[model samples]
Target chain A: MTDEPRAWQVVLEAIERDLLDGRLRPGDHLPGERALSADLGVGRSSVREALRVLEVLGLIRTSTGSGPNSGAIIVALPGGGMSALMRLQVAATGFAVEDVVKTRLVLESAVAADLAGASPRPSLAASVSLLDAMESELSAAEFLALDAEFHLTLADASGNQVITATMAGLRSSIESYARLGAASVPSWPDTAARLMREHRGIINAIESGDSASAGAAVHSHIAGYYAETNFPTHRLDDMPA
Target chain B: MTDEPRAWQVVLEAIERDLLDGRLRPGDHLPGERALSADLGVGRSSVREALRVLEVLGLIRTSTGSGPNSGAIIVALPGGGMSALMRLQVAATGFAVEDVVKTRLVLESAVAADLAGASPRPSLAASVSLLDAMESELSAAEFLALDAEFHLTLADASGNQVITATMAGLRSSIESYARLGAASVPSWPDTAARLMREHRGIINAIESGDSASAGAAVHSHIAGYYAETNFPTHRLDDMPA
Candidate 1:
């Protein structure tokens, strides 16, 4: 435990400090690899390795070649990295399906209540637009994808980056299960229709500024679907919302 | 876009599938680097890289040299990876301090309510022990660390792995900010005394099965601490909880 932190970790923490201290912001270019190596007194290879990790974490984008955009640029796309972390963690068996669904219930219900309660409420225009798209004739896969987006859209509208990112990741990590469960529903059309209606019900509750109902609507909307699915080991019945 | 998946990605996905499918339970050792490289038709270096990513993500622990306990072993410890990912993200400016606090409130309050509501209550013994640990004379840092653990122990008692890991990540990410805020707290002893009282209050509420009060207690407990802090920007005043 007393061992010196590795060279790459040193580079990572230095860059992190720079980011935290506002030396790096979105669209800013990092000092070149050679310059970073010299400045930090680490091998160039260590700099490259840290940059790769940063890129994978969606903090920066690295481009190859000698053009003006060749070096790593801070993009700070939090959603993608969070989504990947969640998706991979679920795939690696670290998160159970029941826990994911339960966590989603906690977040989405809060978002619904918050969004509805906001002064001059934030735009649900994106969500409204997506609901329109869901009405179009599409494959089951496409509809489910949009369904996931509608819930995510509400989270996005809340403008809380942590909730939005976590909701997106949780929704997506279970997407494959959603896709699989689609086949088991008695009638895809009926199920899809019911979900679309529930989506509007949630929107109505939020739009009306009924905070409590908005929360309840989101809760029942999620739980109702889980009740209908063949999700194997997890059941939302034990949970009221 | 049609480029073949990278060899390392293929190896990573294969291992993830093995874990998801129950072939790679915790304590199982991954195949040797040479064998995995040959089996997956990727170079040994690519296999090593994928293994390195897995180790960093806390899905496995890698040990050097020849022994039964050596090589990469599946640890599947979710909290460490989630904590590292979240801490890095927060440092990189992907998560606002305000958002982290709000997210923690959402998850922690839900855990409080749920634990109080459970018919056959899960053990609060761990949290009880942590609160006792907090009563000891210690540095502000040590007290705050134990404070963080007390909250985490409640989430753990909830038995929701996702919530537990996410709360651990969120709490640890803001730790430095917490330490920094300690200086402006006016009287450390008074603040620590209040926090200890609130800790007992939360435990008392949960034990008494007052789910609503349990939730409120947690919300106020957190909001009260933040209210005292001279945290540059962000406040809990905007949202009630």
Candidate 2:
């Protein structure tokens, strides 16, 4: 509980308090860097560094023009903070590919099961469309991207915000790993075809409102992918995509 | 991308850039308040605010004093961040008791299943101890905390850092719900007794290396709890715990 403060840290705190307390809201513009420096007793460089981190998290939008609206404005980017944090951790920790796959299997299966049981049942139409798009995707990179999107869409349709966010973060963290792993498969077409079939089974279960089948389908779909390979590993940062 | 930067957001981005680039590692002290204010061109108040949020997220530790170790230090506190964020989000979202139970079912059951089938197998002894602690806890709050520790331990045993973190986050977020829901039961002792029994069953399954039994036991434990109350609903913020 020491009280010696860092100038930029203090500045960060000031902004966060406003957001939590409602003094700041999305789309609100902040004071200029120079004004803030004068008021907070910190150097201009420290302030710039702080803002850069927030931008990376997608919490604020920065404009460079001389217009009134050209300053930093508060904006809420979906899954931005979560995505950034998980990606950093993934890269930092160097988590294994098997760990990721198993986690995915657990997460997606849960989502699918929940979706199956929801009284009003979410639509899998969007998921079906994504799967359809993936079927025709030409390159491994493109196919992988669409594949990630498809899973994300399915998670989103589950309507559980916490699960949705967690699933998205995990998926995104491994998105690059997944792409590289996909590229390494000796039979890309065969793997893609297998994935497509799995996706179809999952969608079918969800459409039929069969929670058990949906959960089982998603579980097998994910487990099968990892089983086919000995969980081929890749460093997320080293991934080209 | 507009260039008008929000003062605090600017500070955030700057910090992120440093973190991503590995310029600042854990335990590095940031510049003092007045100096950073001067550097970043933000008010002292704003810098303070941003630091608060970062602290809440478990990214940095801030101490105020008259000595060398008295400023903000970049330190890793993933558990703290996950716990705090989950608590806040659960409060804000007003998730149902059933939602929490459902989530636990999915995560814990899946972990059990995965561990059961693991080639070399993993230990479930630590989780068993946690369950025992929960059983012996004198108060509802204490029991709830131990219960969370139990599940987190299980997640770790699954040997997936990603799922471990995710499970920890999910459990922490709904901790209040678990506490409140448990306390809300007609007889706290009876409820605790039932939970202990269920935990024992799951532990036995895990100890015997029966993956299917472990998964089934976990699922039954969670599903049974929810069924007891017919999935009682409550406002997230007003949850008992």
Candidate 3:
């Protein structure tokens, strides 16, 4: 015989089913602990536990005061939840650093090409500004951080939350990889200048509606850095046709 | 003034840094709880808490009785960790249904094309068998179950652990989406037959080493189902080059 689900899991699943069925939605308030416990036939503690996990997962926001916003409100912000999951998984060493970068190459390249080809291209205004900010004198760490933001800005323009979230999740690994390359680099200034140029090249390619060049530019920008850094890249010759 | 770090987070980060530095590797036993607390200057309970989280994330294994094998040992089995994170995120309604499928289309299509172009093609014996099994007499539910597995089988055969995990993580949504389509269709047999044929078309194209056609076939198969089912698909024409 199958084992019964845990009490908190029962509460969690019930809430999830409701959300899936449109019985609950973003911006809706969850029932209070006592009422949920009674309705779901679980203890108040189980309800609380599920709620705490939900809040931590960025599904709901809870405030302590008895004001109108005191209770848990569904916000459905998936990006933060995705980021936390990926961060913890990375910290746990569950993901290999190499796989993280490979995934990024696939997603970010797709995002750039998608941006380049859209009939009415989403504004690269934010991305352009981030690049402008990159030209300022900054530490290797700061420039790489802005570089990470620039890539995320492109993913954001794609308006695909899944790709955006996945890119956001892998942000740290991408930065860490580039930083390792920077560390071994002979001169931070030279590497930074080259990186800024490559970044500008990518933006220019996209803005000119050159999807092939935009995608290839991103692939080369990332793969080129790793190649120079002595990282064993997944053979780029075999990238998606 | 800066607040002190959470005790458990300090322990977690310390372990993570060691993992990043190649100090703690998969299958290496973690220091005993007492030793870890002493080394990190955290309470014993904090050490235990961090270990508990790590175990839950599938990064470690712990057992009781204080035997030689009872200590926590690193296990970098990331699939479960990725799956759990995604499942919880989906449960929280943190990911949109459309974005999830859109991601699947992108990843699975790329995976199929990658498989097509590999010099030493990874075995598709597993995938072939799954497809053969699908042709047998089965209800829509059983056929759909096999269908989901077939997609994952292709992803697994790609040899990219991240794509494999992401596909595995998205399995439920894929199945749920298909089941919805199957339920609403006027004839399950007609749809199933068409789906089976499309599945065969994808495999054949890959086996023939037609990377472009292999990729296009997959994109069409997925986008087609969503189209026939009245799902609002992200435009397939804009798929990655």
Candidate 4:
């Protein structure tokens, strides 16, 4: 296997398979590089290369030194790292901005509905306060930052780490385009006011335990803003009208 | 910057910032290692490490040989690589399986609804054929391959690459657990028959252009399968009942 094409990939897959089988897990220290290479019958260089990929993917952390923590240890999925990768992918690949907005509508609406349906409904106090903060005088940049925080809070309220992480990952890409779109709004104050109203409506629906309304409010809030900016509203039409 | 902690990270962020600002894009070739090192004031090794990270993230592909394509060229996001990383992450981190299911319900339901609303409705003929093929006798692994293809087709039909990529990435992890859960079903034949029926129902709803019913059917089909399998169904309760 070491002599085969992409020898490092073989080592990566071996580790990945072990992970999938639950043989390795978070906090489990990987064997030392020399030992791993010997066990897998691959060169130490191959083992090191494979570990580099895993580390970049947030699967493991390596510490330097002769201490107990020197070797690689499996780690929790690094949400921030995943988000950074996603933001970069979205930026470099030029995935259609409209498609991202549509995707957000689907995910955010579901998140809002999920939060609304939770038995002991998650508190929207943090989210609502963001809305309140928005009502005061602020620059578009400041308002957009809070706006993102509000949506991220809603995603967190869904209690699904995957959803939360994904939303956080896409936020920067979404915000970049949103900031561009914000520049086109006829009136910043009016646009901000409308956004605030929509935010309040979404919060109220979630607080009142109205799942359908909560979903609808989220969908409308996102779609309305894009439509107002005249930024290719065609995709929004496919969503609930 | 070279003396800073994680200097390679500085190189990575510099390129990422350029990508985000639209200074870099798909199909563009990155500067050679020497030039990047000089421009970023980092060592060539740091530049190489940063490039390797970007390559693993599917943001670029490097070709060897002193030809036109020898350098790292920005590439479209590689869905398969992302999927592999996600599967490994889910396995190593023990991200709650139930959280994955709930996230699926949110995503798949939205995809079904979106397909139903497409103006020149995306064809479900391929999807319908997969359902037809599943009716014949097959092993669990065979059935699962078809099942994944079916969901992926629906995701593709929604016309959002991001959602499609995300669904594709989650499919393997979901399939691993779903296969395990399948073992506990009271009657395999009964469960398979019910799944087939639900697939047809979802297809019919989409074909008839009833977005709401299509979404509802997909939601129920997934939630129902988990419920019947006696797999931890606690998370389903948080979704809209």
Candidate 5:
């Protein structure tokens, strides 16, 4: 006779297969833990554990409310899951930070190249709006928020939603470090000015449908910042002051 | 005074910080559901809901035993996670299957280019071994398995684990369809022979440090598969019966 499989694995497989089969769309609500356990012939505890794994992937949202539908609602992929996993791998010595940086540069450059060839000029209205917001910002935090919006806009204009989402996740995962890096600059104004200049150049290239130039501009922009700081990639312990 | 934060968000942040800070690691066990709920100051059910999200991410594995170490364990990222996510997006109309194929071609071509560099020469041996394995495979399943290994080996030889892992994930995700497609060709031996020839060509390029040819060969190998099938490119729901 076959030894019964673990209850949690059964629960995990059920949900996973549903996801793979397209039965569970993002935003779909899952049954309550007790109900799921009962239906699957598993313990409630096992059901709970399976759900935890899915959350790490940013696939669903969980909440408590006094109703039948109050449980895990399938969430859109979060902006942090990919980078969180990447960061974990980096921390675990599976890869190097430099390698990650290089990967990012390559992927982002590819995105820029795509943007350049886009039939309609890349729409930077959102990016421009964020740039406008940044122009008036005085504090580091204020500027950093706008800075994120600008980069995300660039990713979006590339017209690759999957890549844009992944890039956004990567950028946001290291966002605190980025802000700290910006703050550490002796000449904050100068650093911001440099970023603004690069942003302007990128916007110009996108507007002119210059794919190669846009890709090169993004490469230089990233490389220049790292060079300025001597590429001060931080460890997980090095959170903002 | 600020109200208590959402339990699920609290659970999500706790897990994120734990993973990032090295408090929890892949393969490390988490406390039992009852204990975790008490420690985190939430009801047991809220804890379960949080767990659901994590499971979708391929992050944790859980089991039953009353002992302290017998509970949820953080696991290595599963190969299925990326594929499942991509499948959903493809199903959701976020990207076409042809877009996925083109993206794969772009990524693999880059990997082939990297393998052409001398510094990464030692890594190419794995791909060569996989090619040998494919030559001896007798069954479709065995052939598919070796084919998967060969592609993954190519990724590793390219010297970027991130890209390798990503490509391996995407390839494995669509693998069943790929195997079916391969089975459909009336001239199976001819198709296998063609693949062997392309593999040899790629191996020769890597051996000779010819980056351009290696990249071009891989591109042609993938694109040629579609052309041989008389399908211009990948399309949704287009898998062979």
Candidate 6:
């Protein structure tokens, strides 16, 4: 007899292989647990375990009760699931703050550049509106929320779901850290003003279709703010200003 | 009373919060399932379910039997779990091949530039060795395996675990598609020769510390090969050369 956990893994991989090869697709319902267990020569419990993991990973949605939709159905990767996974991993692994910051700079700057380079150019309406909203008096938490929305909007404008999902995943951790870092600022008003100006500069660069300028502005905007914090700044100095 | 699935989600989020806030870390043993369920006011099954999801995500390692070492121990993010999740999502959702290819160009180019810019400079010995190994006669599957190793080696050289994990997650899908595309090549030897030349060019650029050349070579190297396949090529034309 197959070992219990290994049996589930085998079932998972079999289903995944079908998905990867295009034999399974979005909107398709997987066979019932009994059917899958019989077909794959595994216990029903093993099949259920595999389906549960798939549901958590956002590869499928599972429903209860007996009906045509009761089994697992393939679906688009949910952004929320991706974000939660990223946040959990970052938290659990304790990735260096510097590495996370640098990674963000690389990803976001590229996003900005891509948005700027799009023909006919993508609209920055959502991002610009967030910047305008930032001009109002707001607490650090409120400001950070808008700041995240602005960046996420820009990521969306790049027209890449993978980049957008990654950005979404990183946003919560970035916000929490930014909140903590805000407590150490010598002058909140000055920092807030500067951040607003930088946000506008990023928006203007994208609006003007200057990919290089947009990329540079995003890089400095991120690196400059992080430099003020106690987090190591030397790692970022190597990046072009 | 909380429903079964919701209860597990609560337990999952509770553990996740601890991990995110630095209370839990790699090598730390989680409380026993019975104790955790009692403390959190849930059934033991919920705790077990949560632990199972965490293990599958590679956030913890669980061993059997009774001892200090028996319960789930927090662990660093495992690349295998991330890769499996990504591959499954890509497969089930049918993420447009064009989008996946463009995302690779953006990420791999940045990885190349970072490797080129590292101080004291990273060695390309491992990557170069793979290129040398590719010169020998090999089947499509064999060559693709080496090809993946070469790219992964470069990703590792970039010194970012996050990027490396993302690249690893994308590798299998990339390999499978490349294998399918290879069947259409008019002459395997000529295509293999051209790919070898491009690999040499990428390695040379990194070795010479030319960030721009390295980035451009990677971008074009990916785009040029994909252009020959039935996959959409127009998506790449908009990307910066």
Candidate with maximal TM-score: 1
Predict model 5's lDDT versus the native: 0.69
- The count of backbone overlaps in candidate 6 is 0
TM-score of the A chain in model 3: 0.87
**Order of candidate numbers by TM-score, starting with the best:** 1, 6, 4, 3, 5, 2
Better of 4 and 5 by DockQ: 4
Docking class of 3: acceptable
Order the numbered candidates by DockQ, best leading. 1, 4, 6, 3, 5, 2
What TM-score does each prediction get for chain A alone?
0.92, 0.86, 0.87, 0.80, 0.87, 0.82
Indicate the docking level reached by candidate 4.
acceptable
- Specify the highest-lDDT model's number: 1
Segments in model 6 whose C-alpha atoms lie over 4 Å from true places: A1-5, A17-24, A27-48, A62-73, A232-241, B1-5, B21-23, B31-41, B63-71, B232-241
- iRMS, all models: 6.8, 6.8, 8.6, 7.7, 4.8, 7.6
Model 4 misplaced stretches (Cα beyond 4 Å): A1-7, A14-24, A27-52, A60-73, A230-241, B1-5, B17-24, B28-45, B63-71, B232-241
Q: Write one digit per residue (lDDT tens) for candidate 5, span B49-97.
A: 6765555445666566666556777775534455555554444334445
lDDT of 3: 0.77
lDDT tens per residue, model 1, A72-191: 998877777677667767766678888999999999998999888998899999999999999988878999888888888888888889899888889888888888788889999999
Expressed as tens digits, the lDDT of each residue in B53-117 for candidate 1 is: 67656788888799988999988777876776777778777888889998999899999999999
Candidate 6, residue B27: Cα displacement in angstroms equals: 3.1
Proportion of true contacts reproduced by candidate 1: 0.53
TM-score of 5: 0.80
* Candidate with more favorable, higher DockQ: 2 or 3: 3
Ranking by lDDT: 1, 4, 6, 3, 2, 5
lDDT on C-alpha atoms for all candidate structures: 0.84, 0.70, 0.77, 0.80, 0.69, 0.78
lDDT of 4 by residue, B91-140 (tens): 77545677777888889999998888878999888898899899999877
